[model samples]
Target: MHPNKLRAFWAARQGLLECDTHLSPETVLEQTGWARSVGGVGPYLTLFTRAGLTRPAIDRAVAQLQIHELPSARGCTYVVPRSDFALALRCSQGFGDAAEVQTAKKHLGVTDAELDRLGRNVLDALAGGALDPAALKDRLGDLVRNLGPEGKKRGVTTTLPLVLGSLQTAGEIRRQPIGGRLDQQRYAYARWADSPLPEFTLDAAAADVELARHFFRWSGPASLAHFQAFSGLGVKASKAAVAPLGLLPVSADSPLLALPEDLDALRAFVPPETPVYRLVASVDALLLLRRDLALLLDPADVPRVQQIGGLQDLPSHAIVDRGRLVGLWEYDPEREDIAWTSFVRPDAALRAEVERTAAMIREHLGDARSFSLDSPESRKPRIAALRAG
Candidate 1:
């Protein structure tokens, strides 16, 4: 874990995730910059956007990465860039608002009544600024009509979940623990949905296994348990999915196992002397291998971080150096900016490195500077919530 290796790992991980190319596992493996850390689709979007790729093209690229499919009565499928609900809503309305909600209704084929209900949901989301899955489920309870004849139909509400499932199958929307009630336990959000899918298919155990292989390739040298965690697959399915990947059995030593490429990149990026970065936990949801969060974060920090500024703070789309998160990044629409935050008692050498990383993030963003992250004035309501939390 020399500094050079750490640097290389971050470079490769960041590069591959930032790439807009439609990469199969083989192609991704061949890329020196590809890391085994891109299970979530959000960072993938940044990679593609930074590379000047469009959303549709990215979807095609993700589809090319698929190795399996699932079957479901709803014809539901799962993949990376899991759900585009937010993006779909954005595509329809450009941002959050009642008008956007209306557009989303049309996009989902829901009726005016449904749209109104949806509008209320969207408005509430904007006001709250983050959706706590369980809270939202409670909030929306008695409202969700399951698909069927009496209270259900093959209409928008019914199809909505399938659409979300398709994104999940595609690696567009990822499933993560929310520590909420069962119904709210699995809520959906999107950071990678810009990569729109033309279809979604279910992932049977076999398909799940194949997909797990893809997960490992992008984030491996990881354990079978890690693979299952990353892919949300059962042990049998996960093992089966990756069995065909031809993984090299290099050694039984090393606590931090990684794919050879990841290992090599890690060697290049993780400096043994100093690996300190203040990474946003939620961003880890889209970056760190789902199964290996403990490696990067203190177990105790997870919940507090997840509940606090976690959801409201737009995903911190920046890379961690050594292990310290040194950059601040944002994707306000098309522009992606990563500002180098002041370090805690940074030495000259570290400052120089931070500047270099910040420059790279800025270069990737180009002229898109519509968003700014200057601490906002303490508004009455937010101040109240801040104190409350």
Candidate 2:
């Protein structure tokens, strides 16, 4: 497939071209597999930009347990829909490698049996009701009080994280938002209610296959290595998972793969001649779906996008023009403003569109004050040149 066409197709698949009214926040998450929630804000911005969901609606969904934040692929926290929670968690089981276990043991100075005991204690504490981390730590008392000097150095009062991490991966418990804010990271621990969790009994192989299917549906025209990297599955496992789907190869040079059903659509895709712009979140799906940098960015601008010696250090948020990355943007909470820098000199029409987008951002920010056009250090020269004109 042509790279530009592939980009446009991806944009459409990501729900960037148009937001469907039928697509709820939960459905959006299910379709996209998961939204990055490491910083807590990414998932909210992602849903807002892609699904055209308002902050109140997203918060209500999360508060009602319609969507959940949990550990999943790549062992990172993701905002996953409740429907896929069980499967997502089940697939993440055994995700904590031996190295992590050993590190936990060394830090907490706890044996396997002791860790098991702690896990049991934690479950017992939360059996009655939800409890935030501080309350849970107090409830456990001496059991987790002294997590050794190593744990203290790490600024943890207890080794509850070690046990809780294991339980979360095993689908025993989950994190619930402390407040109604989408950007809030404070959470309370609650039992993983079997009533809400899906009962689809797919074995590891079947589950991995289903996961691969979802990955392709949302992030197709990708390579096997991309799946492996995103899913954190081994090369052999990744190949096995995607094999049953019968994906078609895009080309020999790229060796990209796509779902059979999407082949015709991919072939029919065409990049828009008119300039289109979108202000995307830091870990947006369109940017995260593929691993290859060359496909998304120009070779000359690669250095500006990535860090020294790092192949994949993208900006916190991107300013995309049509299917190409044209700039970067970030929000300053203190200043209540949007700070942006552009790589391309946008014409009057594009500039007006950008201003309209800024207005949308400002309105969505609720009480935020203003917007600015100052460039970061990396793009200072570019901004200066644009102004010099």
lDDT of 2 by residue, 118-235 (tens): 8899999999999998899899887874666776775544667778888887777877777765455678888876733356688878889988998999886888988898888998
Q: Can you write out model 1's per-residue Cα lDDT over 124-221, one digit (the tens) per residue?
A: 54254334444545556655444445224323334234333433434344333233111112343433433343343332444454454445554445
Q: Which residue runs of candidate 2 sit more than 4 Å off their true CA positions?
A: 96-99, 106-108, 151-157, 195-198, 306-310, 348-389
lDDT of each: 0.38, 0.71
RMSD of each: 13.5, 4.4
Clashes of each: 58, 1
lDDT of model 2 at position 81: 90
